[model samples]
Target chain A: MRGFGVFTTIALLIAGCGGGGGHGDPNPVQPTSTPAPAVTATPIPTVNLVLQLSSSVGVAAASFSVGYEAGRGSFSGSGAQAQCQLGSSDTLAVNDDDAGTLKVAILPADPTRAQNLALPTTLTCSFDETGGTVTTAGLRIGDKKIGVIDGNGVVVAGDSSRLDVR
Target chain B: MLLVVAAVGHCARGAYAAGAPSCADPNGDGVDVIDAANVLRAAVGLPSTCASAPAACDLDGAGGIDREDALDVLRRAVGLAPTRDCLPHLQLTEVVHDLDLPLFVGAAPGDDTRLYVVEQTGHIRLVKDGTLAPTPFLDLSRTISSGGERGLLGLAFHPQYVATGRFFVNYTDTAGNTVIAEYRRAADPDVAEPTAARVFFTVTQPFANHNGGMLAFGPDGLLYIGLGDGGSGGDPMNNGQRLDTKLGKILRIDVDAYPTPPSGNVGGGDPDVWDFGLRNPFRFSFDRGTGDLYIADVGQDRFEEIDFEPRATGKRNYGWRITEGTHCFDPPSGCNLTGITLPVAEYGHDAGCAVIGGYVYRGARIPGFVGRYLYADFCSNRIWSFVRDGARLTSQVELTDDLDPTHALGGITSFGEDAAGELYVVDGPTGLVFRIDPE
Candidate 1:
């Protein structure tokens, strides 16, 4: 039953994926927070790492959480938005304070809007280098892994080539 | 929460691009958290962002997207039973017209294409493949008394109808007595062998008005019969409380053994009396999905009711003259309500007069209606539905507006469920039969 449901949902997603080619949003939406106390401090270097889903199959929905060493730096931006143009879709990014991770959920409001992302849909995460270096090994998707629903409602099992952070 | 609400409101006001699909997903992506959130907002009476794709949100087809729709979407997101199909809107599609005061509609077991309609003039007509057969399936007009609730009223095909070719009927004989008779199907599948009707049970009716002519086969394979309290106003004969008489009671008899009472019936009464104390149980049915019983008992003066009993519950005394729909009737002010089972749902005469019982929807065509009980009023051209959750009645929805928008199908005589469990409506006054279809 679970397999069938997954298949059905994926198949519906495929219907949403219309035209290919992703649309990039250079400007990222920022999260709001209280102003920190002003003081003379060393400039912290910011690193923008792009988490890309590079599979051939178009995705209508995707869910994954980004985890990193909190002591290294905080996620400078609010959340991730789709670079792929799926019309009338919503992406929800929530920061889990206890787990020290940012959970992102991308779904199309209308199924027909599901489309293939740019060759690599990039989710740029800005990291403030506090103590350790933010390397590809240090950055990882959460233990739940990345769940990408393709046009056929099948969960695209993420391999190194399909899902990557750089 | 505030941010989400604000985003949804903004989306609701956003104009749909030309040629865009009708759904809330602005990006035209598949259903995800955003759509579910929008549906949840609409369910709570807030504006739904699904203005663009409204059909995508109204999953169960009860008209207007609500909480259930939202829940269905959420369930789909998580891979649940209902996918993205919107609940089909209830529309009365005329299937057959020009019958002679049809009172009930049914279908033979294993027969999916034909509908058997019982005419009050004592002929069971067949509507096969959407066409009414010119010849009546069984004609008893000459054998039974016609007019005013007399004549042939109910029919039930045996579960093994294809094999045994046996069926049953409940009607008032020429002498005005309630008769449970068995008949066989002729060589032609659409015809009943009229000469072979073996009358197995007959109870004399004191008055013509409340004969309570409804017959059904229970899940236990026993023939259950409905009879009104000996007739007249207020059940003057007081037959409802008496078990010795089958009047005003639902009797369960083993037709296979010819009039023998099924074991575990009401103790010490007329051995076949399963339940007593009903004024006129005009219509009742056993849920095909759960085997539970639902009876639409016609009231005396004030209230009409829908009574329910879980499967296997025995000897329940539904208050009739003692109480008309949870209110004291016989003693007028304060009669003993103890030990008497009240109706699960009731409405006053202000709403409608005579409750016409219906079946619990177990049909595959309407996913939203599954498990919900649908019934109607004989006087008021209205149909209502509710889902019984344990002992509580919830999700009560009046479907008159959605189904009979013009009220042209006057006087809903009964609600019929075919072999597949899809329901139909019988209009006695208009001599019409309508299948409930998704609009």
Candidate 2:
């Protein structure tokens, strides 16, 4: 019954997550576009948000997306390189439109987690912290609302994680 | 103009006009913006412009039509049932090598060339392009218990593994406890990311033996697991008839973490369990064709039995200490079979000491085994089968006569299938993965 789909997820960010003052923003990872060769943008001030899970209750699949206003920013692939144990059979998708948005998705190779989970998991993302009035649109765990953590380590319900992406 | 892929096979049911399949196109065709509009009317009980068929409309099976049925129809169109009605033979052909105490075998969805074999020593080996890969797909021996009915016990691939590359396993961890974990194939698609292991669930075992560990994705898409009564002899903990513990029961959970019941047929709504009252249901299988389940529970001192149930007979209690198979076990005189669901067929120690549950042959190669439930014994090392009509056992025969003894099957631990629905057999001692071939 829980559908953490693209549109539903987008709607969560747009409708549920509210914004705040402070030019701080969580830098999200931006994926590549068409045949345009690789080019790093001008250095932009960014804040990395690390969401820590209270329990590694087996995350089979997950995704996060947010929209903001700033000079385009992206993730540094900076935190916990192996934050999650993804299988060669798993799928990790990232989408960051140069405009002002970013999305991250990970699907595990097994759903039952018969091997137990990599407990106390953490998600580290990056984006322009100065993106004027930055806020989270949505965060999902296993396509369901299990809470998410802000860079401040403050836990927020997945469906209503309106904390400043900063 | 929107050309929808999910829109084609996935449609809204019940809301269709008379005699149609689903809501989107009614005729079970592609979807359009107005598809929801056309179906919405019928769902709300207002007449619909789309055609509706019995398969889509009469979903509740209550001999009536309503909005709930309409909503259910829509859910059904999203996921279709697997193919059934396959008749296989009751024979065997040796394949694969000393799988190292191979406990279970499974093929990834949509992948026909590859098969995964799980060994009791905590290693999962891959059989690709007709041979065992040099490297292990997974190695959990460092964390799993390796001796005496322990180690890796069960394996099941995600129904959508072709697109998900996911699979589940049941094993006894180093702590001497039962554990169910999930692992994904690494970037190589062949090897698993050992570090990516995540524990889905775990249970502390009371004893070493009877650590019932068998997992399978049900026809409903919910992950179904079979756990024994915490592994002691004669139900010492009385876990078998006790609903309080997960031991001696079959549990079901939506791995996607999505709401369950996929399409109803789930008779009980306990949310976490499907049935209970089993004694080391070491192996069980759902007939690929009918979605019916056949469970072979190991006995205590005298009997070995097989219990059969349809897709919706949820919350079943297969009389354990109270009754073994269909007869009285604990009670010497007056025992009741009243509320208890007895095994459809049972055998004595004279026939086979331990019942190794097999599958209902639904393969193309074995024309003879098409509708029969094939099973074997560990002590006698003999094979047997029976036919199931609805919930009853109609015929019983010893299949050991059909097989060639020269090619010892070792000790049958589990049976598995490939993407094409072919049959296979595995032995925990010799590690041989056998297939049912031409008689």
Off by over 4 Å in 1: A1-166, B1-87
**TM-scores, each model vs. reference:** 0.63, 0.56
Compose the digit string of candidate 2's lDDT tens values, residues B1-439.
1111111111223332233343234434432212222233334443333333322232322222344443333222222221122122245677897678888898887898998999889888999988999899998888799889899888888888877778888899998899888888888988888853567777889899898888988787778888888876889888887776778888777777734433332243334567888998899888889888888899888888888878866778889888987779878447877778887777777766888888887777766457777787877667665677654454354445345334366678888888887878887788788887875
Could you give candidate 1's per-residue lDDT for residues B317-392 as a string of tens digits?
Answer: 9998899987899899979988799888888777778889999999987776688888888887667776777766
How much is A90 displaced in model 1, in angstroms?
A: 17
TM-score attained by model 1: 0.63
Model 1 chain B is weakest, by summed lDDT over 10 consecutive residues, at B1-10
lDDT of each: 0.72, 0.62
